[model samples]
Target: MRKIILSASVSLDGCFEGADGGLDWHLVDDELHTHFNDQLRGMSAFLMGRVNYELMARVWPDADADPSSSGPEAEFAGIWRETPKIVFSRTLDRAGPDATVMREVDPEAILELKRRPGGDMSIGGARLAARFRQHDLIDEYRVYVHPVILGRGRPLFEPSDDRKPLALAGTHTFGNGVVLLHYKSD
Candidate 1:
C-alpha cells in the first residue's frame, strides 16, 4: 500500500507561520526547494485542505511563466501542476484540472486510495493533517525544522490527549540549517 506522508516545514518553536500569517520565516532556498521537488516528483497525489489547495492554485500555476522565478521554483510549478490533487472541503464548489474535492474524510475511501497502484501521497494542511492523524491514516511524517525561533505563530500541532508514537526512519540535514526529520507511525 502507498503511504500517506505528512510533509511540512516548521520553525524551531514548532510554528508553521508567523502571527500575521507570514511565511517569510520559511527558509526555502534553492537547495531546500530542489529537495522538495525531488520528493514531490515521486508522489502520486497531494492530499490537502481547501485553503492549502487554493493558496497553491493562486501561485504555482503561473510561477513558471514568470521570468523572475528561480530554477527550483519553475520546476516545482510543473510538479504542482502535473500531480493529481485531492482537496477536502464542503464549501469549495469546484477545483481546477486534475483536482478532486471531497465533502468529508472517509477512512475507507482513504484506505482504498492507499491501496491503489502508484507512488505514495504527500499530505499537507494542518487541519487536514490533524484529521488524518486522528483517523490513524498517516503512515509517515516528514517535518522539516528550520533554524529559527518564531516568538509567535500558528503551531503545527494542536493539543491532543492521545499519545501517538512515531519511530525515527531517518534524517537529512540541508546546507541551509534545515533538517528533515523522517518519522514512521508506530
Candidate 2:
C-alpha cells in the first residue's frame, strides 16, 4: 500500500502558524528549504485543506514564472506544478490546474488511492492531517520543528476520539535549530 505521510513545519510551541495566522515568522532558511524540497520530491500527490491549498496555489505559480530563478522558491514552483493535488473543501468550488477539489472525506477514496501503484501520498494541512490521524489512515508523521515559539495559533491535533501512540523513526537537527522528526504509528 502507498504510504500517507503528514509533513509540516511547526514552531517549538507546537503551533503551525503565529497568533496572527501569518507563517512569515516560520520562514524556512535556504538549507532547510532545499531539504524540504528534496523531501517533497517523493510525494506522488498532496491532500490538503482548502485554506492551505488556496494559499499555496496563489503563491507557487507566481514563483514559477521564471525558469532561470534558483532556490527553493523556484524548485517549489517547478515541482508543485507537476505534483497532483487533492484539495479537501466544502466551500471551494474549483482549484487551479493540477489540483482536484474534493468535498467528501471518503475513506474509500483514500483506500483506492493507496492501492494504486505510485509514489506516497502526503497530507499538508494541520486539520487535514489530524483527521487522517483520527481515522488511523496516516502511515507516517514528519514534523520539522522550528526553534521559535508562537504562543498561540492553529494546533497540529485537536481534541478527537482517535488517539494513537507513535514511535520515533528518526530525527535530524538542522543548523538553524529546526529538528526534522519522523514517526510511525505505534
TM agreement with the true structure for every prediction: 0.98, 0.93
Per-model C-alpha lDDT, please? Answer: 0.94, 0.85
- Give the backbone clash total of model 1: 0
Candidate 2 lDDT over 72-161, as tens digits, reads: 879888788889999999998988778899897788888899999999988998888876775788999999888888889877777677
Q: List, residue by residue over 40-90, the lDDT tens digit for candidate 1.
A: 999999998999999999999879999999999999999998999999999
Whose TM-score is greatest here? 1
Backbone clashes, each candidate? 0, 0
User: Among these predicted structures, which one has the highest lDDT?
Assistant: 1
